[model samples]
Target: MSDWAYSDVVPWWPYVFILLGGWLPTDVWRYIGVVSASRIDETGEAATIARTIATSLVAAVIAQLVFYPSGALADIPTWVRVVALCIGFAAYQLSRRKILAGIFAAEIVIGIWALAPGLG
Candidate 1:
């Protein structure tokens, strides 16, 4: 156990345990949400609140990426990130609020910016 702990690489067992530890709580909540939502009308207050909370969480994550990124994202210029986000939001609005389209647009724009001569 000491040797495993000292090594740079984590053993397979720890990864398995880590995966389960990370996934179980989220999966349990997801299961509960699915079961609970089955009985809730889509037009009900509860459903609206759930949707609002989910949207707020996504927005918070996007805001965090823009304001407090780590690793490679931290290295990107703020203007580039803001531009990418604006393009993404525009794409989302133009694409009838398709989230994937928006995300892809942002990623593509940033990727092109990074690949541009003298950038990144």
Candidate 2:
């Protein structure tokens, strides 16, 4: 075996291609968003769809964390995570749906939970 991880290496050009390949897909969409946003109405169906998609993505991430946690979070009990989520959601709603408040509440709960006697 050589000092490299792979037997074959294509050098600089291939690395540049790989970088562009990873960036172009998302970059193209961002440019499209910039162009379309100038004509898109804030209250239109497209805006609603975008908001719904964003909300769904966030919900999916939360679900993933609760159902299949990783790293240090995996050590905490699932019920505790769910309870923290609930408290965060409630605090969010109570604070007129403020995102930061909800995040802070959830983080505080999780931090305390991590400090619990039997937890890590």
Candidate 3:
């Protein structure tokens, strides 16, 4: 059984691992959060701290992706990424901090950069 789990004899083994190892663990937490959400106080200090931490983590991830990217993103020049970030931030600010607007603006810039010849 262990050998079969590691071998390619079962093509769907990896999918089973993904469902068990990845999805199930996260889904448990999501279900718990959903069940307990009504008990959370939105205006409480704990909530405020959670929000701050979440925002900081997101910002850190963005910074890491832009400054030290891997894989396909690494192929794009740093200047292009910075320009896209700037445009996206400006769009977000101008659109009253709409996240989709910022994301769309950044995507448009990156798409253009990828498509245009001699731009990268």
Q: Who wins the lDDT comparison?
A: 3
The stretch of ten residues in a row with the least summed lDDT in candidate 3 is 1-10
Give one digit per residue, the lDDT tens place, for model 3 in 36-117. 9999999999899999999999999999999999999999999999999999999999999999999999999999999999
What TM-score would candidate 3 get against the native?
Answer: 0.78
In candidate 1, the residue pairs with backbone N, CA or C atoms under 3 Å apart (3 or more residues apart, or in different chains) clash, namely: none
Better of 1 and 3 by TM-score: 3
The sequence of per-residue lDDT tens digits that candidate 1 reaches over residues 12-117 is 7677777799988889999998888779899999889989999999989989999889898998999899999999999999999999999999999899987898
Off by over 4 Å in 2: 1-15, 118-120
By summed lDDT, which 10 consecutive residues of candidate 1 come out lowest? 1-10
CA lDDT, candidate 3, residue 112? 99
Which candidate's TM-score is highest? 3
Off by over 4 Å in 1: 1-24
In terms of lDDT, which candidate is stronger, 2 or 3? 3
- lDDT at residue 3 of model 2 (Cα atoms): 83
lDDT, candidate 3, equals 0.95
Off by over 4 Å in 3: 1-16, 115-118
